[model samples]
Target: MFRPENAQSLVGLALTLLVCWLLSENRRAFPWRLTLGAVAVQVGLVLLLFGTPGAQTVVSGVNDAVDGLAAATARGTQFVFGYMGGGDQPYQVTNAGALFVFAFQVLPLILVISALSALLWHWKILKWITQGFGLLFQRTMGLGGASALAVAVNIFLGMIESPIVIRAYLDKLTRSELFLMIVVGLATVAGSTMVAYATILKAVLPNAAAHVLVASIVSAPAGVLLARIVVPEKPGQGGYYADYGSLLKYDSAIDAISKGTMDGLTVVLNISAILIVFVAFVAIGNSLLSIFPPVLGQPVTIERILGAVFSPLAWTLGIDWKEAHEAGYLLGVKLMLTEFIAFIQLGAVPEGAMSERTRMIMTYALCGFANIGSVGITVSGMGVLMPDRRTEIIGMVWKALVAGFLATCMTASIVGAMPRELFGY
Candidate 1:
């Protein structure tokens, strides 16, 4: 069995916590119980999911399910886009270049998954799962009911959609609790996007689905722990729980799917627009940077700048020093742009450019929605949900983004600390 990279993992974990501590509003009253408990929970999950045969079987099942889902999406695409959606063409070209049609493949999955999630919610299956986990968060971390529920549901729902579960309690939540909610939102990826990411990275990492699921689970508690450390709960503000009965309801099963499809379309369009604009901006920035001077006989670009800036952090996460810069570039891309772009770029990383270990570390690290753009989404979405908390939400966005970033890194460290045997290395 391959041994854990214990030294690097320890440094990563310490550095992640230290960064959170440095940014803490009240270092003296740090929630040690919550912090330690969250770490225990993350470690337990990593061992159970990565080291056990039974859990591996379940992960395989999820992978199989995702494959089926992807196939279904392909059928729908074939019906609409014809051969462009992977259907057979009348004649094949002698040397056809690969096409990157975002509309035909990537965006459609979002709509399908969103609709399925809505159907599950309508059946109350999602409610049970969310509530069960919410209760666990409440008991283990001593979180108020509303905050715990919001964090728990976030595993399945998007950040903005999750707050709707505790909408009744949003205005009443303490500043600390509200901030925790925002951090949880940024820390975890939604189910729809999670599957999309898994599909994108499937070629590079065969077990992408399992890792994404584990990342979401581990980050929830990590976010809570970091949020508590950064801004401790005030005196006389504990044990408050929102009634589960206050959840929003759908008109019917059909309504749920239809509404979900519509919502997913909006998300699809937003993602397309964001990618087009942000990617163009990056290209523009790189063009300008390239004019300055050459670096090591090559023109300086945005990727090189990001890699140089974040290489040390990547090394702490158990990436080999030689390959850390490349890994760091992916992390920086995720933070500056989006995880979707980062994953796409990751899959396209030339063979032998980095070791498999480095690729795995970057995959775990970048599996979050903590980009700069998400700050505006969280602030505005929560602002509309609870108009009174708009000012508070805006104030907490930067800190929440930092906490979310640290939380994902914490997950990476825990995974890195696992014996390579767990990853079949």
Candidate 2:
């Protein structure tokens, strides 16, 4: 089994950091302490959660709750769509295999989790957790209070929704702080979406829920650390803002849940539409590629092209060379499309296509929301919240995407370096 103390893992860690450093906008001013601290924190948390029996039990409990939520979603879908939606039926049929109908089985959990998150936010439970995390970032990373709070909130809320928490300070934020927010937002998946992903990945990875939760938690600080390197803060420019007040509010518990459900419906519909369109596009692209001369008795396609291009990067993240191309293909899919699409494809991967260790690394690597489509969404959503900074946000979009990509890869490399025995592999 792989161990963290090995030379190969150390080389992987060094190469990961080196790539981030080489991409730094201001190498001289890069925040080494923040980067090192973020790595230490991530490794520490992973060991505590994966190596310790007590923490593993807690993670298992959370996974159980996720399973329960998934089951409840099935019940709701079954009630509406009958047997096609996973309900009991008198005779066997292929209706359950329909893409449109299958979406109902998994996507409804987004509604439930989103509504539950809103209710918790309204009750200030999420606020307390956000504040606690914010303070840690403020103290450790030297981030302003508003920036730290926004980054922390990104763990639970969507990228666009998180900025609303620090709305008042958006314009006043320093360049580095603003970019950090964007990078963190792109780097981490929202909690509601995380549950949906966990459900999708449950078959191949039994501990998918725990891994998704840990990936989000680690990526926040890691994103900030990487963002600072890419766009280092100017001296005497960043400080905690104590006056940013709460922007999320509700009339009552019912109101919170109602609005959350409506918002989730929008997300669900958006995802369904995107999947339909993107999948069709990929198929069309592959058809065009099929006209090319065969390679190894198979027609060249987008996946193979992506694999050839990004396989080296995947190998640097500690994926085995033999499986690096497959992992790279998934990574490319994530960058070109969305993590949701990439994960759905991952779920469909044939057994023996990649080793279990490589799958775990890919899971963490592709956990972010950084993709070409997300750039437009971030710009439009953040534009609505802070119109004055729309131009700046647009300019920073590509850079933020790169930073977010590196951050997720950084997390994956760190996880890959950890001893496999710790995960009982």
Candidate 3:
């Protein structure tokens, strides 16, 4: 099954690692052991979640929740369009396929999941779970305590919310630790987005939530390795919180829902604004490209160029060559534009343009905000949270962004290449 495309993808990943190392401020002093340990722990987590029946049940329950949301969206679509959303209307749909163009179209799951997650946190369920994971990271990966919490919270919460959990110590984090946080946040998607992603990729990829969920979980360690290489941890680094109790504070269920909904609203608004401009720009670019038609030379579009450039990388993740380029185009758009924009485009890919495996891998790869714009946001947001360390945050932005992008790529490669049965597909 291994082919030239696979080799190309591997080479691309290797090149990314090289790029990370070359860009590091102190690559010479990188902590190799710690990096390897983090990778090992991540691999183990993936195995436990997917391999064991009991663990799979829990994860599957989460997946079921996302699936239910998708189904509900279909119903809501019907309610809004008066049977048109029920597959009755073939040609006329909104900008991104107006299935149910409303506030809750596919994003309500974020509110639901956020509320539930907050409840779990209030009940100490997530706290206990993350504590064990955190202990392993501390003992094995040798990561700073606050950074570990950020990574775990990233698996559950939005980037902005996760960092606030450690707000008290933000000003004290080291350069390497802060970089790791930024990379992890950018590499992983928030739980609220799972339903939207599932809805977009479900037609082409089986077990969409499973793949996306696993991708975020696995990206943590990959982010750690890349971040460390970019700015090696100071051997005797101090000022990291080691105790868990101080950081784990939970309000009641009502408070959780209220706060969680507000958080989801911010995400929704951000997605809306970003998409309006990004799509406009893409349309403009396409219009410009349309001038040079097949009459003079073959028609060229932004998607086509991206597909050609990233197709090899896509194939390395076990995607068939026939569909690799389309998948690659999606990845390129996700990285350069925004994940929401990419997901919308993904839903509209011509029938049979991408294979199941390729679509699945692209979904995982494009789950987070690993683009250049996110780098600026993270640096600004986290810098303000830690005003004393603004300079350090600025220093690590570029490296963290690159690391985050590569981490998602690495996660896709491993998960996509593995046995499909692992995803219950």
TM-score for each candidate, following the candidate numbering? 0.97, 0.95, 0.85
Q: Best candidate, TM-score-wise?
A: 1
Clash count for each candidate, listed in order shown: 0, 1, 1
Please write out the lDDT profile of model 3 over residues 1-425, one tens digit for every residue: 44454555555556557778888887677666865676576667677777776876777786787777667656755666554455466665565445555454565555556666777777778878777766666677777788888777877776776778888777677767777788888988777776677776666666667767777777777787778888787768843775667764656778876876776767777777777888798889989989776533567888888888987767766677777787788878888898877877776676477556566667767878788667777877777787777787787677677788888887776565456566564
What does candidate 2's lDDT look like per residue over 1-425, in tens digits? 55533335456567656776787778898677887788887888788788876987978897999999888888888888886677776776665445335477778889899999999989888878888888887877778888988988999987988888787777788888899999999999988899988988888886889998889888888899888888889989978585534567888999999998998888899889989898899999999998899999888999999899988878877787888888889999999988999998887787667677778888899999999999999999999988888888898889899889878988888888887767666
Q: Write the residue-wise lDDT of candidate 1 on 1-425 in tens digits.
A: 43546568778988988888988998888777887899888888778877776877987998888889999999999899887886777686564545446678778999999999898988989888888989988888888888888998899988989888777777688888888888988888888888888888777786888877788888899889888888888888855677876586789999999998988888899889998998999999998997787989888999999999988998899888888898889889999999889988888887568666777777788888899999999988988998877887888899999999888888888788777767766
Per-model lDDT: 0.85, 0.84, 0.72
Q: Please list all clashing residue pairs in model 1, or write none if there are none.
A: none
Q: Least lDDT summed over 10 consecutive residues: which range in candidate 2?
A: 1-10
Clashing pairs in 2: 145-240
Cα displacement (angstroms), candidate 1, residue 393, comes to 1.3
Candidate 2: stretches off by over 4 Å: 1-12, 93-101, 243-245
Candidate 3 residue runs with Cα over 4 Å from true position? 1-13, 52-60, 69-98, 248-251, 293-297, 316-318, 419-425
